[model samples]
Target: MATHMTSKKIQNRMKRRVALNKGMSGIFLLATSFGVFILGVLFYQILTEGIPYINLEFLTGKLSTNPDRAGIMGAILGTLWLMAVVIPVTIILGVGTAIYNELYAKQGKLQSIIQTNISNLSGVPSIVYGILGMTIFANMLNLGSVVLAGGLTMSLLVLPIVIVSSQEALRAVPGYLSEASIGLGATKWQTIKNIILPAALPGILTGSILALSRAIGETAPLVVLGIPALLLPFPGGLFDRFTVLPMQIYYWTLDASLVGEYQFLASATIIVLLIMLFILNGTAIVIRNKFQRRY
Candidate 1:
């Protein structure tokens, strides 16, 4: 009788522990749902306020002191120019570094130290990168606040992310593939170009696109570089002074208190920015799904 009673008590305690776990899980789920709910509310607000103001004139017209005539053409051109520079620089350096570290660098204290530093750099604040860019590219190189300067700054900001992601993709490629290529007497560079890169391209491109998207949305670094809000002429070259979509939205939102139309304009710009980010992410997803290898 005594033994039976002890077993029953132990069973009851186990039941209570499971019930507690379930309760905590439900609480966690609710908290996650709340965050999604808040994000949805914000999207709804932006869409409703901004949708009506999006049109050809608003998209194509140059900035104006009069809110009625203002548009985002210069901002759009500047953004394209920045991307033109950012995409190439980031990909070449990022992918190159990833390949070297993953395949060429011997695993040791020095490699470990380099890996740790890269991981830490990935978490550094965007503003810190901006300050560095201002010092190196802007002041030291005397590039000023031009598209080239902004592009280089943003490149540094996203470089670590691209490198980390590329490494992961390369690491995921099967070792057998590389070994077989070597057995076939293929040189390292040829093997990497033909076998490894094709297999890893999906992940590499996905990470690159995401990194570029982050660069596009960033404002703090650009603000630090002192990109102007009112570039009358569209940036036609890398060296031209420029402003981007984020800067336009930021400046307009600030001006909204004084000019009611500025609020709608800001919302419209926000919508465009959202679309740009969506396209970039969607492209990444599509590429990932399309080229993802079984091995």
Candidate 2:
């Protein structure tokens, strides 16, 4: 009788535990669904405003006083140019910094200090970067307020993000690979270049996407760095005065006179930005899947 009672009590306890777990899981699912629903609503709103306005002419045409003739060609080209310069510079600087921090430096106070500063910098506001760029890259260096100046300033804002991401990727590479390469008579540089880096390439590319997407969307940094109020035609080079879509929208939105026309333009531009982000994120996913299949 006593043994039977004990078993019955244990069974009841287990049932209660399962019920509690199920209730908690339902709550979690409800919360997650609410978040996804909110995101869906935002996407729907942007799409409704943006999709109908997008046309080939709008994409290729120059800025104009007439609404029907207006397009984003110059702004689009400027953004592309900014990305071309910023992306490569950031990859080199950020990856190099990560390699130095992870592989070369011993865990010392100096390393800790460097690490601390980098961490703090990632949290620094983009506007602060604009100020720094204007003071140093623009004034002191005399690069002036141009595409190159803006690109350099934007690069600084994103540098810490890349370093953090690159370091994580590098850290994920197995230590044994480094040891084996060294044992096979490879130098530290050789080991990193050939063995560890190749293994970490997928992760690095994934992180690069994150940084690039952010740079593509950022407006205030460039604006504060003195992106021109207008560039009706596409630029010839980095030094040529230029504007980007975000700055274009920002300029137009604030103009009480042109708000009705520019508001529609801004909506259309935001849609393009979203599409670009989708492509970038999709590319990252494809790369990740391909690498997984191969490796």
Candidate 3:
């Protein structure tokens, strides 16, 4: 009887496992079909409206009244300058804060306050951030809506996001790594800098990519802060006012008069934006995989 009962239990467990595997395959197939459907729709729409307008002139020249003469030179330059400032600052501040919180600080009232505020800041509306930029960076500092002001304002908006992701990445590192470092005669700071940080660098980089992608696609924040969306000459300095791709896309979508032109430009901008996001995400994934193998 005992033998028979044991065999029955084994059979029931096998049946349950087989049923779960069957359900898993069905769920995966549904998810894959949805993803492919969306991707195909997006590809078709972008190709339909964007392919015609994507010429050398549009890619490399200045915005012009000739329509044929217009291009994204200034918008591209502005975006580059924004990223040049925003990325470094965000990484330094956000990752620094995360490292301190996870590897150094103990759970205390102050830590709780900081965590709560950060979580709240992350949920705050993007438009609210725009208003803050306008009031503080632009108005108080009198930066006069230059690229620097716009970038800094956006920097603050994305800082919380970076910090949150960085903290999570750092947290994912096993506590034993730090414990082993401590046992090897390194100070806490040295252990974090040399051992923990290098191990977690890939994850932090992944967060940076996510933050930057958000920055690149943001329009309301730049627009509300008064980025000139139609600059003809490419900006030569960070302090110089500039246009960004999202701002250009927004401006194009504003008027019904330039329907074909606007639709064409919007689709092109979408393609450019998507391509940039894909490259950054791919790089992050590569780094994550590489570092995971290294340590």
Question: Which structure among the candidates has the greatest lDDT?
Answer: 1
lDDT of 3 by residue, 214-254 (tens): 99889888878988766447888978888888888788767
Cα lDDT of model 1 by residue, 1-295, tens digit: 9999999999999999999999999999999999999999999999999999899999999999898889999999999999999999999999999999999999999999999999999999999999999999999999999999999999999999999999999999999999999999999999999999999999999999999999999999999999989846988998999999999999999999899899999999999999999999999999999998896
Model 2, global lDDT: 0.84
True lDDT of residue 39, candidate 1: 93
Per-model TM-score on C-alpha atoms: 0.94, 0.88, 0.87
Distance from true position, residue 154, model 1, in Å? 0.3
Which candidate achieves the best TM-score against the true structure? 1
Candidates arranged by lDDT, highest first: 1, 3, 2
Which ranges of candidate 2 are over 4 A from the true structure? 1-28, 255-258, 293-295
With a 3 Å backbone cut-off (N, CA, C), the pairs that clash in candidate 1 are none
Query: Model 2, residue 238: what's the lDDT?
Result: 84
RMSD of 1: 2.0
| Residue 60, model 1, lDDT | 97
